[model samples]
Target chain A: MQGVRIQQEMSLFEKLNILSDAAKYDVACTSSGTDRRGDGKGIGNCKAAGICHSFSADGRCISLLKILFTNECIFDCKYCINRASNDVKRASFTPDEVCRLTIEFYRRNYIEGLFLSSGVLKSPDYTMRLIYETLWKLRQEYHFQGYIHVKAIPGASQELIQMTGFLADRMSVNLELPTAESLRKLAPHKSRKNILGPMRLVQNKREENKQEIAVYKHAPRFVPAGQSTQMIIGATPESDYQIIHVAESLYQKFQLKRVFYSAFIHVNEDASLPARTDEGPPLLREHRLYQADWLLRYYHFSASELLSEKQPNFNVLLDPKCDWAIRHLEWFPVEVNRADYQVLLRVPGIGYTSARRIVKARKFGSLDFEDLRKMGVVLKRALYFITCKGRMMYPVKMEQDYILRNILDPREKLPGGLGEMGYRQLSLFDDVNFREVKAE
Target chain B: MLKRRFICTDTTIGILSAIYDAWKMDRTDTEAGIPLWGTVQHEMFCEYYEVEENERKAGAVRKLIRERLGKQAYSDISYAILSKDEDKGTAILQTMVAARELADSHRIMEHLSHPAVRRVFEMSRNVGREAHYWEEFLRFREMKPKILYAEITPQNQVLPAIADHFADRFPLEDFVIYDKNHASYMIHPRQKKWMFMTDHEQKWEAAKELSEEEEAWCTLWKGFRKSISIKDRENKKLQTQNMPLRYRGDMPEYGKS
Candidate 1:
């Protein structure tokens, strides 16, 4: 193709354009929790609170120099834009080129670190070696102490993955599809065992390195921020229940710091993939899953509690917490003054910060609804579920549907794009600026 | 109930020394005996006692705070000093006084019921949040060889909090982050220590014309930003929520790319 042929003689910027666009669908650009400061002789350092240098049009935070090492692949994954079968432009960055780009980009303070991933080229070994060389050069030669999150080629040798782990702050092996069956159907070259194998290796290496550092005090860190993995959502017909459980298992088994979910975009024409629709890539579903995941990680919620085979999906109208609260009505009207911290956390409006604030504020005096509002509780949502001094904010019934209807008030303003006339086509009246006057 | 107002400079040390002078003035007979106020304008109907900044007195109060409370409280006080709140100096003093009587006073950070304690805590958290955001939002342009310059207009005075992070991240380069609102700047010279210059006479120079290579990189960055978005998920509302419009002016991706 013309695009493919022109790419062979392309400039570095052109290559970057193609490769970064190819890589964007993966959706794991976080650069958090790496505390490796520059060793005075180095060029950069990583702080715990990751810097988001900019935001893309998609509203995703750009924290790293997220680019694929190359777009030349050996396998044909149906969902991937960079699949070998696709007649798209291909480009690869040399080790020195990647180093130079990272150093220069970092010097201008454009990025916090580099997130290097790639499609397989020639062999997994060769592709991995090139990545390792780039990272090794960046760390050893350039002395770039900034965060580096690299993707581990699933079937790459244990030695190559281990060597690269020492040079990176974080490593990820994309568990692209959740289940083994879906992975087989979509990515024929990728296997669940091959992916999990390297993930296990990284986990073990981190464990061993932790012990080594406990004794030696300088036994080079292994993925100091720990490994994170991403799973493609809305693909292969996996239920929300299944996806949530898989993420939980990954956290429990692999010790992952994060599990990113990418809403499946129908990029290619394949019989196995879902039909393309104007409704877009299950963005709302992906949002719900992230909310549920937050509950799992921070709110001490179990996946079973959030979802079950009986009720497989979350309520699209209400948040996961509200839905849960509606289902388990007996848990409602939790006395704010009497409930424990964990109980307070389960209340809809009281988040981690406000729950703690409530507990601390109650120490000096008894807190009313007004006090709860002052302490940052979302009273509109929390009113039905919480009580101040054993009195509900309103004389409300304990019926589920009633409470749900009350919570989803007709007058209550919904988040943008979820309200009336949300997806309306352009109309003559849409541009009119009508001013409503109040009657005296 | 005429209050004895201690007028002091705006720095943390100035306020602390004022607190020290008030504590030693023996004006306990009056109902609202002594209150610390910064030189900055404030509504007042009280006798003003000008307290010159005494490092010795400030040091004594600092030691008293450390002895009664702990190191963490001292740091909280330092963070509170960076708050733009007009009542910050008084809030820190009252918080210190209240903290002495509280049980496990070191953890007096959790005592949000006391108005002063809450104010100090909220002020510190606000400053800390701004510093955290600046760590992420501050954009640097190479003005000269090995010299990187960034400009920030943060809500609070946060240059002092974020300077070490950049210096540590780029130890071999000279970087300066100017806080336009506070009229202060932090400079980190190559391989040398980082330092803060407050109320300096230097006016900010316009951002230099980007080098050809820098221009190319900016173009590439903008391209990456444009190419990354799934057009169907273009939520300008959400984008503005995450990366505010105020921060977009300096960001290359949002600039004339």
Candidate 2:
């Protein structure tokens, strides 16, 4: 890997244009869950319902001023545009430059916060320290009280991470690959242990700091919004079961707030990498994983329940909840009025809020299909699973193949574009496309 | 054949006063159904009973609500009154009467079978959804060093709901979030109180020109917006679904387009 040649001639705007463009591929741009009212002395506050100041062309939220501290790297990761061997124009922001951009953008309300990630400039420690200084200056000097989500570089010093964690609203360490073997194959410089080590440290310190703040009101918050991680899907040869298990374990072990799944877009032209196709990034797979992930987080679904070794992936035709319900037909025809909140949650069309509403609304009076529709339940899906007072919306068979055919029938307003998605069985031997997966 | 029509101002206090007046007349008789009308009505041959906005009368009704119903019920009525629904006034009044008779007004809110309660619930939900959307969609562009400004045209009167949010968000910076559709402005002075001014008497103007730094930030933001999306996965339908076309004019990225 060749050394980075820092561009001395780049203007601040030029650097912003380059670095922000470089940072675009990273998908964790959420600015949520830290509700801080601005102190009279500070410049900004954060709302728990994070504001999306703008929408990108890909329909993703632009809530933060997401930019790379530098595009210069010391490691040659094949998936990244900023790899040391890549001949991209490299620019690094001075701590002051980052602070100024953050403050200015925040003041104008162009962003809700700053999402500062970087490539390995010299070493993890050096890059992380620069990020820490930028955050420190933004918080202490500029008196910016908005949300800040910073990446905890793998293999960075623990002290630097702790310091940055205190300054940032949320901290994250990207796992990049689902398994260590894949990490070794795709990103030779990065190890699973190197990434998870800082994640564990942040988790422990955040837990400790939470206790400290609970006891002492004045103790400063350490990642008050908690931590999250991202995994690059389709880049590795891991099955959906493996990916979900990795995520589920991360949630249980490290106590991550979220595990973002970024669909891999093929970038580099290497003999070792798979050739790109017109099919593009595996967006449908990524979307399915996200839907499954939501089921895990909010719907009280275990990853194993959503997928197994037998069917190791989600069906592209139906959502995770509906698919699960159809596979296990015994639980169908749940009594809308009598079913508990948990049972109601498993119903295909009933969401968290709608399920809660059913429980609340039914106590006052009897709820029929009409009442359920008014409460925001999609009757087309829920009718097969739910009964109002002992009668189904329509007499339906409990047979799996029968229900599947009926549900997939084009007459029923299928979810989004699922109806048009050409049915193809999950392939075990299809040559996977090369997707440029970044761990940032 | 005397028609008792209640003419009232189009405000929370006005509506409450009208509700109080209407609630007192014929609690059970179908023939004596006192129809509530805002000042923006012109109905001939009806005996018009003008209900002025009185704090004492409104407070009495509010106290009755707090005593008979719960605080949640009180806020539900408050939020329901902000809806543009023409029948919201009568629906809330009917709910208040029905709710007063019930053992639990809170429980009555979930009784969707009842017409009055259902209407009130729907109106409140509409207001809540609109307010939640504005909390996300309201964009503030810097007009001066400490002053920020944005414009919105929401379906409901959601300025009051989001004012406290922006005030808490930017305590040190003054911002004016003008609701163009409702002809109201949520103005928060730096390090001071925030208020909703409904003086539609003066036409509000957009900031003539963004400051130099503000312009740069807008340009940078526009650049970031274009650069972020993967061209292969561009979904305009989903984009509009999340951020409706109504909000595009104020957004810098969509402003030029």
Candidate 3:
């Protein structure tokens, strides 16, 4: 690959411009505190939650030199700019070019490391090999110790995927679509088999590494940052049930560090894609999915609890947890003072922090309505479900829809007469006026 | 609104000094702070007062945090205040004061359940998350002899902490991270910029910055971002959140067509 490229013809700045830009959208670049050590004379250490240089507006974090091996790809996916059929300029970087740029950027303290991906140049194996080789050079010849997140090209040879496990700190194979059929439709060149094939192989390899380390205490490394994959939500017609079901399996089977949900974009305005008229995208739906994802990962809520096949979509108005609580009335009104941590967590307006607060505050004093509010539980949703000293706040009937109305109500909410709001319930342009709101 | 000025080495240390002095003043209800306001003069009444910075006081504050809040708390809150979010400073103050009621450090997260505390906790989480991402997603290029330039538009005031992280990690490199909302920093480990950018200005000259080869690379990145997959278009909402519009100006993938 290096032989095919003109190195002297390209400077370090040129490589960075093409490579880093090409690489930016790959979501796998994360450097939480490896906060460990540089190990004698080696370079670089990781932070636990990771260190960030900046944030992209959509509020996604940016930490590394995220870019692709080249913007040149063979696959003509309907949503991608790099698809072969697209009329776009292309650029590729040699292994040496990436190495010099990464080292220069690292030495200059510009980035934490390199997050290298490609647009599926040539074949899957060909693309994977170039990325794998880049890491090998950075690690071996340059003695680069910074974090590396390499894209595991789906359908790439198993040997190539294994090499990623061995060299990179993290490896990812994006589950471009939530379901098999959608995968076939949007990314026709891609398939469930092709994507999951590398995914399963990486998962197995990571498991073997974990097992090896468990026994020997020091085993051959295999994606120590672990494997993560992304699911493009909202692009196809997959229901939340379909999304969560896939997520549940990904978690159970892959031991993935995270299964990122990248909402799809209409890059080409294909006749096949749905046209969103009013809103540019479904931010609320995305928020709900994140909430559900949190439920699945941290909260004990299962995919079934959050959504069912019958109800394919989440309630646009009510949060997933609140929506779940309303459906399961019997579980509510549990004595907060005595309920288990998990039970307390199940209440709406209560998160992990509040759940622990209830646990701790309860030991000091029996929690009532006032006590609950002070303890950090927002009572709007919890009001109907909880009681103070064996007394319901303002009892009345246990009508699910009635209680759901006020909690999810948009009319009376907000500061200075902001009308019925969106998913987060703040008025439109809330993000724009955050400063003004804070002042108030 | 009263205006007071104190000179310190740099931004973080300066902010820390001001915070320390605010702690020492023993003001009740409202805090005694500096207004990162004022054109050239450092003075009063903002949406909120920027804290007054003192070196000894700031150092003591750091010690106090390490003692009371634990080491992680120190790093967490410090990083939180530096996020690109406008509310970063005020949010940390609330979180810090709330956490003080508890003796143990972990109790801070418990305080985080409260709305005021939650705001700061969210800020910390945001900054921490962004820091993690910034450390990963930053695109860097060696402009000329030793000029390492990178552009970023974060939602929080993360550049300072990120700078600190980068300084330690890359002691030899001199780089700049542009905060699109505010002004860009002229950063370098050799001679770090040592003042608050209260009088900072913006200079976005495009022609000189991009060479022909550099332009080609950006074109490829842009092309590639357009190709990934379309069936996932329903997730545009998620995509929008993950990569907000405000950032497109600097993002190589969405360069001017």
Q: Candidate 1 falls in which docking quality class?
A: medium
Better of 1 and 2 by TM-score: 1
Q: Each model's TM-score?
A: 0.91, 0.91, 0.63
Q: Write candidate 3's Cα lDDT for B184-238 as tens digits.
A: 5635534443222332454543223543345544544334234322333233444
Between candidates 2 and 3, the DockQ winner:
2
DockQ-based CAPRI category assigned to the predicted complex of candidate 3:
incorrect
Candidate 3 chain A: 10-residue stretch with minimal lDDT:
A412-421
> Candidates' DockQ values?
0.66, 0.62, 0.09
* Candidate 1 local Cα displacement, residue A211, angstroms: 1.5
Task: Output the better candidate (2/3) by TM-score.
Answer: 2
Candidate 2's C-alpha runs over 4 A off are A1-8, A409-440, B1-5, B23-48, B63-68, B144-146, B200-209
- Model 3 alpha-carbon drift over 4 Å, by segment: A1-35, A40-43, A103-110, A141-143, A215-220, A269-279, A367-381, A391-397, A409-440, B1-168, B171-257
lDDT string for model 2 (B1-257, tens) is: 56556667667788878767776775542222224453246555666677876988788888887777778778788888888887777777778767756667656676676678888888999998888777766667887454688888887888877777677767877778888887898778778898777756666555666666677777766766776677767877778888888766676666763
- 1 or 3, which is superior by lDDT? 1
Q: Which candidate number maximizes TM-score?
A: 1
Q: Candidates' lDDT values, in order?
A: 0.82, 0.81, 0.66
Model 3 C-alpha lDDT per residue in residues A43-98, reported as the tens digit of each score? 56665666554444334444577778888887878777677878655678889978
